[model samples]
Target: MSALTAPHLNRWLIRLHRPALFVWTVVLLGLGSALMCLWGPLADASAEAWQQHYACAPTGPCLYDQAAILRYKHIYDYATMAVLAVPFLVAAWTGAALIGRELEQRTAQLAWTQGLTPTRWLLSKLTLPAALVTAGTGLLVLLHHGMWWASEGRIGSAKSWYDPPTFYAGGPITVALALAGLFAGAFAGVLLRRSLAALGAAVVAVGALWAGVHQALPHLWTPVTGVSSLESDLPVGNGVDVSTGLLTADGERLPDPFCGSTINPQCERLYDRLGAVSWYHDYHPLSHYWPLQLTASAIVLAVAALLALAAFRVTAVRTRGLS
Candidate 1:
């Protein structure tokens, strides 16, 4: 029994999960390489194509490298989506293979007979994987951000910094999300002790976390208000829109009522009836990008910590009962 130690458990853990490690390595390398291409050559090619497209005369034959533009867009979309999917992948794999299988097959019980405490065992399960997930996910996000920055203003059709998928994939938020998924999966596995059931539950848990964050993101920070004349198109604010409506003379905000601009005779009549003088917009600007990202990431990390604590408690209760 003394021969078995934490190091031995960790080594055995890695050995038992070589296949997962290999697959994750492949995913990391593939995404990193693809994003690097986007950051350099692909973005350049697309930007050049757009330049040529704009340079063409209205009455002249146009022959820009449309293929290059499409290729960059396609690859960027795929890579961004893949990065966003990492959290779900982590949750599914961790729940199904890392903890659930051992518990279901009674192998985890056998390991406890050897000198490892349940707490130490759980730590061994989480520590190394958390490190790997953090490093890989962090690298991908950094690369994605670099690629996004390189394309800004250069690629006409490039996704905006606030685009939902781009924003999540290109920021620290995804790293926090991935970590949350890991702990969520562990908690589910310990609670369920069934691989498939845990897998589904873990995915659902992560999805719920993501949805909650998405809904709460705009409200996370104070938004700047933009007011414009009712005759102009809606207030010229272009970030995450919190709200848009008509503002009255007394500075009261009213719902837009889907009224068109004053160019429309009916819209002018409706505005007069409602006492609306101008359009008001509440939104986050580009300057608020880091604030939003950091706030959201911190919230997710806090949730991850809670999930981890819950997992440990569950493990403690179950192991104590067995003992």
Candidate 2:
């Protein structure tokens, strides 16, 4: 059995998952091709649509090709979603096929009886899938970064850099996120040891992780503050406005007395009475993107590492007790 030794276990694992490998290969190639097209034709098409929108809507109802706009939008949306969903996919498979099913079927115990240590088996499962998730998500993240860079000033409908989905897919964090999903799934499998339960638990875990990040993201970076006189138009800047309010001459912040264009006469007089002078905006400039992305990635990868450790330790203890 030297030909089928532990060192060759990864190969066996890959062979066992040939269909998953095929699907991942197809997905990567397809996504890469789609992104490449988006950098060129899709971007051009969307720009033209925006141009037509502006031209047609200048003084009359727009008659431009709404279908073209929608199609480009659909393409971009699907691409973003495909990249963002990689983590959950990893989690589901890891929970269902990697650890959960092996435990549920007692197959992992059989492997242990044949000389594979529980720790080694768990490591093998985590390592193979972690490598695949890292490579796959890394490629997609690079593609998205390139696409975003190439289409920055060109595509009118491309989301802002700090937009949650854009931030999620356009940086190194996506790779870390996929790894986290793998680890989370493994941990759930180890904890639950039931395929369906583990699957559900892992998905919920990843979703909670995502939601937590989304909530904390806006606060991760310090925002640049700008003040505009109440009579002036709001300053046009490309940044995420976290908070906006009217600032009194004494520097106290209060809700806009103008109440966002309703133009309450009483509120207007109250604004003059309270000495509210300017509208202030607290926002993150485009330059803050990397800081937020990296910080978030660091947090996620750290959590993933903890989960991986927990999985190994828990399994080691459980299997030792079983013996």
Candidate 3:
């Protein structure tokens, strides 16, 4: 195929792979939609209601409380895992079959004889899937941003776009990580010439890289640190229960119904008296989001590219025997 036809061929390849991709996409969309719907109701419900509904007793209010659930750390965690992991996993499997299946089935020689360059072949295989993954991740990022903004005061303690959760949670870093895995898996397939074994190796390597970087690098670089507090009124028998809005580092507290209430003597007395004040110190990826994400992604990409190059160098057409 001519240079102008390369994109068409890539699209064709994607079309051919649509069955698997569609299944994976449906699974991802289902997971994301479920979380999006569930988190909202959970956030709006009272702490006691949430505990009773979920059938778990938290030490204090559950993190699903409106103020806490909207936090960037938690939001990004769920969104990113849902949006990125499925595509990456699917791509890794597809990539592992890129060359290994051809070699295993003795089709490499026929393609080589047809004058298809290895570089063009590999590029064609990588570009379409990578683009699909990037687009999906971008959508997920936008969704998280919209949700965070809508939550208003609830998201006061959430990480910002520059936060690590945002970086690793489902954005450019996720796309890059998936691309890296694709390339690495493709390279392993070329080297191993066995689809299953290559796939196993690729999965292990990708998992290790993702987990290791996420766990070890956050502390080594800039970390997110902040304070959050919540206060609520306790009710006596048959009395009204009052709750205060959460307070954050900015010292802005939400409007509480019990504030300045004089009619209820007990409520007024409790207001004057010291109430239950809960404070917590949380570490999120607020500062080092981009730098660490970029650095890690680049490292993985570089390794993958080098492996692909090595595979290209070693690949040879077998005239009378299997590759």
Give the number of the best model, judged by lDDT: 1
Mind giving the per-residue lDDT tens digits that candidate 2 earns over 1-323? 22234666678788878988898889999998888777778777777877787777467677776676677778878998999999998889889888899899997887677667788888877776787789888989998888888778766777878777887888987788788889989999998999889998888889898888778877887888887756554633557667887887778988644454215566567667777877888888888888878988898999899989999988988989543
Tens-digit lDDT string for candidate 1 (1-323): 46468889889988999999999999999999999999999999999999999999999699999999999999999999999999999999989999888899988888888877787788999999999999999999999999999999999999998899999999999999999999999999999999999999999999999999999999999999999998886776999999999999999999988867899999999999999999999999999999999999999999999999999999999889544
Q: Candidate 2, which ten residues in sequence have the lowest lDDT sum?
A: 256-265
Identify the superior model by TM-score, candidate 1 or candidate 2: 1
TM per candidate = 0.98, 0.89, 0.57
The alpha-carbon lDDT assigned to residue 34 of candidate 3 equals 47
Give each model's whole-structure lDDT: 0.94, 0.81, 0.54
Worst 10 residues of 1 by lDDT: 1-10
**Residue-level lDDT for 236 in candidate 1:** 68
Ranking by TM-score: 1, 2, 3
Candidate 3: lDDT of 210?
71
Q: Which ranges in model 1 have alpha carbons more than 4 Å from their true place?
A: 1-3, 321-323
Write model 3 residue lDDT over 103-123, tens digit each, in one string. 677555445444555556656
